[model samples]
Target: MEGMALNQLFGNAYFGRKVLVTGHTGFKGSWLCLWLTSLGAHVTGLALAPNTEPAHWSLLGLDEVHDLRVDLRDGQAMRQALQEVQPELVFHLAAQPLVRRSYRESLLTFDTNVLGLVHLLEAIRETPSVHAVVNATTDKVYAEQVIKNGYPEDHPLGGHDPYSTSKACAELVSDCYRKSFFFDGGPRTATARAGNVIGGGDWSEDRLVPDLVRAASTGSILQLRNPAAIRPWQHVLEPLSGYLRLGQALLAGEPVEGAWNFGPASDATLPVHALVSQIQAQWPGLRSEYLPGPHPHEAGVLQLNCAKAARELAWRPVWSAEDTIRHTIDWYRAYYASSRLLSSEDLQDYVAAAHNAGLEWAA
Candidate 1:
């Protein structure tokens, strides 16, 4: 199943009405913003400058959005920006999203991940149209002393590292706002936890895919942080679809509530070598030799029981692991083939269709 047409997505009687996307310039955020536009939603984006040079936000040409570059940590600035957007749906994704980076800069990660979420929640209280929000958290939000078959939402919230810890804190903040404030009169906020997402245009360092792709491109060996470690690897679109569908259900004031996981089913859990081999198979000339390296602390065998999401949100990853790699590699190959950066249109259409496909399968 591919994505529904733009009209089918937004034309659902209860369309966007008004929407705002925070951190619209990051990898996941950029994809979310593009989907909103494709579905005919009026979107406003607020985030600090794009984190990467060939930033995903700029690469997606979000200049078409009512784009505002502002620091999320700046409470006043964030509040003012949200007041103007007056969104009916706000997606909070602005944060320091890397675990290793958090170790290098723990305070900054906490400020951006924790405080930034607070700013958005407060902003939504003032904005009338903001009826629903989907706050993005990571699978790392759970207290992972060990890897159960799959960690459920009820698992205690804990973090082994700063990034994971901060995301858990963010979830707590969202839960507080949703229960304490939204109970009577406030935006109905739902938190989303997703697994390791790999896809096109993700050039972040310390990530397995990015590092693997970068090394393969240069004919250099990839140094994996923890090769034997396992993760719930799914295409980026899978979890994103869960986010959009969750937001839609929330806006409709459905019985949907609380946190959910959007990730591949158990079969989708593949190791670093499997992912690397799949990616290299698609793009020849990719050579990888594992060198011993230690990365900032990260979970060893993190898996999420996405059964909750599948049961509630009706979401499941549509693409096979091979498909995820093929699509991801294809994007990089196409960009190099054309000798031009991927246009916002190209990226949006591809990922949107992927999301629609997941939605159809879930249905």
Candidate 2:
């Protein structure tokens, strides 16, 4: 929290404080836990176990993450977990986050993403000690809102698919909670809308970055349903850092509320082919080819304007696509290097090195 203002960073370290992370066992959740540990935060995770093969969280040895495995849909269990933790800072990332899979299970998607968030908010309302609640929402929360060039904070809340609509619905719930409950006498509440996240350890299906890594690892051709689709591509650490920074702000009791977009700067937005090409160049030895395949309906061109984050929070992305792809690929290739074994400590060190190597999301 060195770069953060004194108004923020009031509770930077979790030395004796309680920090609860829902979805701590997923790819992004694992990274959040890693960052929180580095910050010395007393963290507890509540979410379903990793469902993907070659498990990302287990791979990082987060099985000992002081984490409890429970579906977010279980209101009683979720509430009990909240009561037990009594966390001061809550990062709610627990939900059905996949779009393609959501097509297969729309009910679960709606139930988990929308209703699950409601449960967390309800628990926060009942439980004391909840100083700040950073609800994780997707950029898709905007209703059919690509907004031509960049989407600002004022963009309409919307989603095209069940997963996106569910996220939009979650945002709607967050708005309701913020206005109705977490207002004058309620806890400081804010929502984070992030782009299509990519990082080292993710192996989930439907996501292009993870799919490419997995295919490369197994010596297979990569398939892309929407090769021309564009996204506000940023490394996993970028927005995670922003979340921490924002949590710091909220805990300090600063007058910051409502939705904020954590994404790369304008130049960081790239199309699927450009992104894949960057990764391919970084991993020359990996066998890969692009073959068309069926995929869920996704935005053709999506972009975000992080001006609100930059103007108010002074947070911005430090890494460009070239460097992000290089570092991301390096983490995987080096981890699986035949000459040496990568330990948990090695992975942590690598993540730190990546963060420190360049301003990558540091402003």
Candidate 3:
């Protein structure tokens, strides 16, 4: 079942609220900041400079908010920045979020994904104004078990690759902090493990949708490392809605803390080739070739059981896999053809569509 309206669910919880978003320059972070700003939240963003020249941060005009450029690995600097912001709600989304790149840059991946959380948690512990936190983690944190059913929230956490291992470690850190300190008087903390998310404005390299669209534009063959690998895919807003709902519950003093899975319905889990082929259908000329090459280890099949989120937060994915791919391809096609990036209008349109689809968050 769908959840309640955003206004009813939030009840002005975000209006005039002090919110801090780490990694605000990244893809999902930019979208979150935009949404929070629309809700009349006083948003402060802390992140490194955008990695890509044509990054979503600039495209979305995120500079309109309180944007600060800082390294999360620098504990003192992060602490100082958090102190200055003194936020009531914190959404931590900063991490080295690529699998192939993690193999080459293992040290940096661990440092940023794992140690970075440590720094942020330390800062949160000292920041008095923080009432709740939502830590964005990946579904890859689970141990790669060859199973068709989705991994539940209590699934044993394990990871083979550096990226996954570091995220698992981050989860452990959050658990420790939640039990040791936050349980008493510290800010409520929770970990959100979402599946592979695809949407507009995600220009990250080594990702499927971006790479496919880029290759199609140049008429180059789209070479996939694991074309047959299955993944739970959803539009970016799906899990983001879960995070916001979780945060709202926390602020309302509801017992909605700890680890949670915000994934798509089981039907959205599809192979990489299928995803590429679907996008090609929408755009009409995306040629792809599966080239067998040396690649780092990745889970052949991954899925998440979002029963907890649906039962507790009343959150469910609004878009189907086909709709998600279509939305993504259409955005990239328009952007490449006219350089018209996503704006508040597009955001409003998305929410309206979600509302039409009976999504509670959009209501």
Q: State the number of backbone clashes in model 3.
A: 0
lDDT of every predicted structure (CA atoms): 0.77, 0.76, 0.85
Model 1 per-residue lDDT tens digits across residues 1-363: 234445355225224467788888888888877767766678888887776666666766756589899998888887888777777888888889988889999999999999888887887777777788888899999887665668888989998899999999999998898888888767787889999988777888788888876876677877666777788888777777788888878877787779988878567787777777777778777776666665567677888887777776666667777666777777776755674554344445445555566564233
State in Å the error of residue 252, model 3. Answer: 0.7
Q: Which regions of candidate 3 fall more than 4 Å away from where they truly are?
A: 1-9, 343-346
TM-score of 3: 0.95
Comparing 1 with 3 on lDDT, the higher-scoring candidate is 3
Please give the range of 10 consecutive residues that has the lowest summed lDDT in model 2: 1-10
- Model 2 ranges with Cα > 4 A deviation: 1-15, 62-64, 145-148, 285-295, 338-363
TM-score per candidate, chains pooled: 0.91, 0.89, 0.95
lDDT, candidate 3, residue 298? 91
Shift in Å, residue 341, candidate 1: 6.2
lDDT per residue for candidate 2 within 28-128, as digits (tens), equals: 88888876765567889998878887666776665446879877788888788888888999998888888888999999999999888888888888888
lDDT of 1 at 131: 82
Give the backbone clash total of model 1: 6
Better of 1 and 3 by TM-score: 3
Worst 10 residues of 1 by lDDT: 7-16
